[model samples]
Target: MGTVISRFLDALRFWFAAIRDVLLPRGCAGCDKPDEVLCASCTRLFRHVYRKMLPGDVGRCYGCSWYQGAVRHAILDWKDHGDEECDRPFALVLADLALKILERQIPCDQARALSLVAAPSSVASMHRRGRWQTLPLTRLMARRLNDHGFSALARPVLKLEGVQGKSVQAAGAQSRSRRIEGHVHVTEDLRGDDSLFIVVDDIVTTGATMGQCISALRAAGARDVIGLALACTPNRDE
Candidate 1:
């Protein structure tokens, strides 16, 4: 009887959401046209493109796409606001970048052994939103990687504290500097032997957040941690 009630409530909630979406339909996040969340044309225009990573670049993490214009607004809407429809297109971009990394850099065998660690959403934000958005995006990317012959699993590794401030434009260089100061904690029991772990996030700003998360993973004994993200802001100097 309890299970039945729970299931019925879940169905009712889903129906309510459907009706709300239809009644308060949103425009394309990019072009603001009244219809789809992200119009087809915007998806094509903002297709994911790969960027090269240089050797011995510790603080410099590899990411795809410039975080500006459509990409910037889209990510803010999804991450800060509850723009749920942004997940699909965002996941597609992340998957494309991961594929590029697998093809040109990470070997097929190594890629298969990799575990994806999604940067944790803030506690307050999660409580308010009722879901960890990054987890779904991570799962979507993992499925794509697995389909392409990579063994990938999304693992929750880090947890965030404090209220998320207004979105700031972070420079890649400043991201490195801010790393030495932030206090982040790892809440999960991670295997030290998981040598190939990809830290996944929706976007990388100054990379300070990713750096803090990677630092926690390394402290927890992860052998090799690679940072991956859907989009990145261009450096201030760029």
Candidate 2:
């Protein structure tokens, strides 16, 4: 029954996209280029990987692009402006980036599962958006990885709890840390799993949220937890 419903919803989404494209064509979500959802130029912006390490975390983090220019604009649309159309592209890009990161950072044991743990969404955000945005994106990334012969699963096991609204985007590192400090709660017992869990988020501004995710998951018994984001805000000094 769940599979059937999923298929039905997928079909509905497809038709809805087709209709939207035909009836209300718009310029590129990024850069306002004419007659494109996301232009090829904007897509090219994400080809490079921006890898970095956050403070007070055991795992390294990787991003597909610097969070600026077209990349930032496109992500904003997909994440905030109800532009669900960009989900597939973003997921595929992220999956590709993850594969590359896996190649460079971790050995492919084949026996171990690759878990994509999406960043937790707040109840208020979910209520306002009427969806768990990262859930589907993470699911798509898992599917993409599986298609490439990797055992991957999307797990929404992390929960953000007991915080005021809109707190993840605090200004500086200290502010960000204080806002989200101890608020990330792991919802399941994934501890001691023989899997490489990658915490995926849309953007990494101060590395605070990603660091917290790594700490929380590791504390919860996840043997390995790394951060993956669509874009990373470049260092301010640089």
Candidate 3:
């Protein structure tokens, strides 16, 4: 059966990873601690919620940690490099972040399903990476939230078109916003969507991209929209 095959493949992957770890002897993605994907000290850094301001009336954005030092290294390893093993841990951190945000924002009595929207990836980036990286993180985060008694689902409805270079390479807020302007689009008609849309991204430098994503969703008739990132660059004002 398909279920049997899936379990078998899962087990196979585990054993293969174990064997590879024994042979290759890798280190923590964050600190290079031997035989660990992400050491406890580094993971503890991701447990805290850091708030950053979004442009205009898009409201605040939440991040799991500040994008600096070990946090930045670990994210770059997982994001740019081929460290796929960091996905589950990063997803859990993001899920914890969502719960923390919802605890303060939404009351228990007033419950609604959550739609986890992965930030759009440009075609060039996807082609270079060979995958839609943010999509998997959003999917895993949704699963984690569902396990914690929330109606959560992953919705990859956003798209990026006509984007050149990368957001990180852009200098300031204005340049980044201008580069992403008119490029972030909603794939389907969300005219009657009532779910709380949580946009997930790997990083929030100036929050321009996150703001743009929120704007696109709002334009497509998505009412309740917010942003969450795995990590965010330091804000001196905040």
Candidate 4:
């Protein structure tokens, strides 16, 4: 009953925000600059790409920017504060990162398709956000890849089970890792098991979630899985 009421309230909030937007236009999500969802200056901040290798032979993860200052504020607004308009700009940056990685993996004349897998949102998060945050970005990315002559498929086959509370509620890396353990698994309905997968996330913190995503994909028979985040936590101890 509580969950039902919570979802109801979230739905109400969603509609209210939509109505408000139609009534009074808002400014940029990264800053209060007028007439843009993301201004040029703010958009450039996402180009601060950084890479981190996973613990094992598992492939590396790339982040467009360190999660701090403007980047952190922008992500929080987009992810938690209902700034849906930021989706495209964020998608553009993520797609750029994916393309850069692809260049190194394959020759310019050779076009290779990859599976763009979005990190699964928990049921609670879906209810709260009234949408899957990463799904839109992933979909747009696949489209952008195809437009650029690379075949790509958006695969949202992973599902989160038995997880509760917001990721922010997790106390530390150990706590986050423990809570998510055994909770992420691939849905049996996914196709093309042998395709390379690029796990798409809005942010990478502690790297616990990305690691779990790779594990779940590998267990489901994926031959390769890498990660790309819009940003990653700066000075993350874990």
Name the top TM-score candidate: 3
lDDT of 2 by residue, 77-177 (tens): 88777888788888888999988877877667766799899898667777766777888889999999998889999988999897554534434546756
- Candidate 3 deviant stretches above 4 angstroms: 1-20, 108-111, 167-174
- In terms of lDDT, the poorest run of 10 residues in model 4 is 104-113
TM-score of 1: 0.80
In the range 86-175, model 4's lDDT, one tens digit per residue, is: 889999999998888777753344345688999988888888888989999999999888888877888898888888747553456567
Report backbone clashes per prediction. Answer: 1, 2, 0, 0
lDDT of 3: 0.88
lDDT by residue (144-186, candidate 3, tens digit) is: 9999999999999999999864536444656867878889999
Candidate 1 residue-wise lDDT, 25-144, digit = tens: 888887787877778876765565534232234455666567778767777788767888888777776777777776777655644476777877656557767788788888888788
lDDT of 1: 0.70
TM-score for each candidate, following the candidate numbering: 0.80, 0.87, 0.88, 0.84
Supply the TM-score for candidate 4. 0.84
- Models, CA RMSD each: 3.8, 3.2, 3.4, 5.1
Distance from true location, Cα of 5 in model 3, Å:
15
Question: For model 2, which pairs clash?
Answer: 191-221, 192-221
Say which candidate scores most in lDDT: 3
Ranking by lDDT: 3, 2, 4, 1
Clashes of 4: 0
Total clashes, candidate 3? 0
Rank list by TM-score: 3, 2, 4, 1
For candidate 1, give the lDDT of residue 237. 61
